[model samples]
Target: MRFILVNGMALRPRILCMLCCEPIGAHYLKEFSTGLSFCGHDCYALYCGRWISRAEQVKCPAVAETSC
Candidate 1:
């Protein structure tokens, strides 16, 4: 199992995919942790609301802004 160091603390190894729940590939952000495992780089960007050069469907929508 792979481990990630966050603020000097070791985070438990966990799968990044939303289906099988296994860490199959590299993570986008080192500190941010999520259970959603993307199938590919395209899927990763789509999952994170990143715009690609080509036309592709956006999976996860951006969060709504809120005033605190």
Candidate 2:
């Protein structure tokens, strides 16, 4: 949830999906630990897939010189 300050009043803005940038409904998928919201399973899966790829790349970076 995000807040907007207007006239000394704080208003909560609509929650949007991090993946699709769409407004989330009552039934939405979210990661409890990271608070990552997704509109549906497809978006969540895509997010996870991307994250895994990034993690793998970071864990095993390319080596300029490989000795056998």
Candidate 3:
């Protein structure tokens, strides 16, 4: 989770992109399983294909052979 200073109040940002670490306000991508957010479809694809499980990685278009 991440917070930002707004109107002198610290509040959680509307969106926190796990891939690029950007604070996205709208049109962001979300992964339902872990409630993870990404700045865009590309970021989400990278995370979903690499950060999580092998099953998801196969579904990604840019699949690569990797070791856990």
Candidate 4:
């Protein structure tokens, strides 16, 4: 979390996705928290789909059969 100073102004840097390694947008920023941020809605959903509670996993269908 570093900022650059130019012309007496500060600027924030772009954040990368935890999965895809791409720039994150404002819509995805809503998911940013606890030092964990995703790139998009689908990225966040897929993340949740993986770490779902075992008891509730049955409710959420598998996003992928195998991890790639």
Candidate 5:
């Protein structure tokens, strides 16, 4: 949750991208699992890829070895 400012005054509420922190307007992408919104598909894909990498890193060594 964020806000738009005008002349140093808060004017309206806004939704910012979870990854880039850019304000999103009427149209945006949302990740249901995390309730995170993205400015565009590119940002969304980047976030998803980031999560995938994190998941990979947290795998147990024995489980990872067995999966291969």
Candidate 6:
């Protein structure tokens, strides 16, 4: 099992599912600018969706009222 460091803390590549928070395998984790660790595809998708929405909101304040 591979490990990664985030915020100066060592974290394993695998993580609990965002929905269930159950320990899963690291194979599902995707590489990102922040770090590498995601429970599964669904969780990753949800995370990415949220990030996109947030980024869009930041880029276009008319779309949504939120700070990046």
TM-score of each: 0.27, 0.64, 0.51, 0.46, 0.63, 0.48
Pairs that clash in candidate 2: none
Which sequence of candidate numbers ranks them by lDDT, best first?
Answer: 5, 2, 3, 6, 4, 1
Weakest ten-residue segment in model 1 by summed lDDT = 59-68
Error of 1 at 22 (Å): 14
Whichever of 1 and 4 has more TM-score, that candidate is: 4
**Residue pairs clashing, model 1:** 15-22, 15-23, 16-36, 16-37, 17-37, 18-37
TM-score of 5: 0.63
Residue range 1-68, candidate 4, lDDT tens digits: 21111242222476777767877655453332345666556766666556555425555456333231
Give a tens-digit lDDT track for model 6, residues 1-68.
22232343334654665555777553456435555456556666666668669878678766445322
Clashes of each: 6, 0, 0, 0, 0, 0
Model 2: CA > 4 A from native: 1-12, 60-68
> How big is the positional error of residue 4 in model 4, measured in Å on the Cα after superposition?
25
Put down candidate 5 lDDT per residue, 1-68, tens digits, no spaces: 12222232321477788889988766676665566667767787777677656667887565344220
Give every collision pair in model 3.
none
Choose the strongest candidate by TM-score.
2
Q: Give the Cα lDDT of each candidate.
A: 0.37, 0.59, 0.56, 0.50, 0.61, 0.54
What is candidate 5's CA lDDT for residue 58? 88
Candidate 1 matches the true fold with a TM-score of: 0.27
As for candidate 5, its clashing pairs are none
Minimal lDDT window, size 10, model 5: 1-10
lDDT of 5 at 59: 78
Q: Could you tell me which 10 consecutive residues in candidate 2 have the lowest summed lDDT?
A: 2-11
Ranked by lDDT, the better of candidates 1 and 6 is 6
Model number with the top lDDT: 5
Q: Write the per-residue lDDT of candidate 1 for residues 3-68, one digit (tens) a residue.
A: 232243333464364433445444432313444444344445444443332223433333222111
Off by over 4 Å in 5: 1-12, 60-68
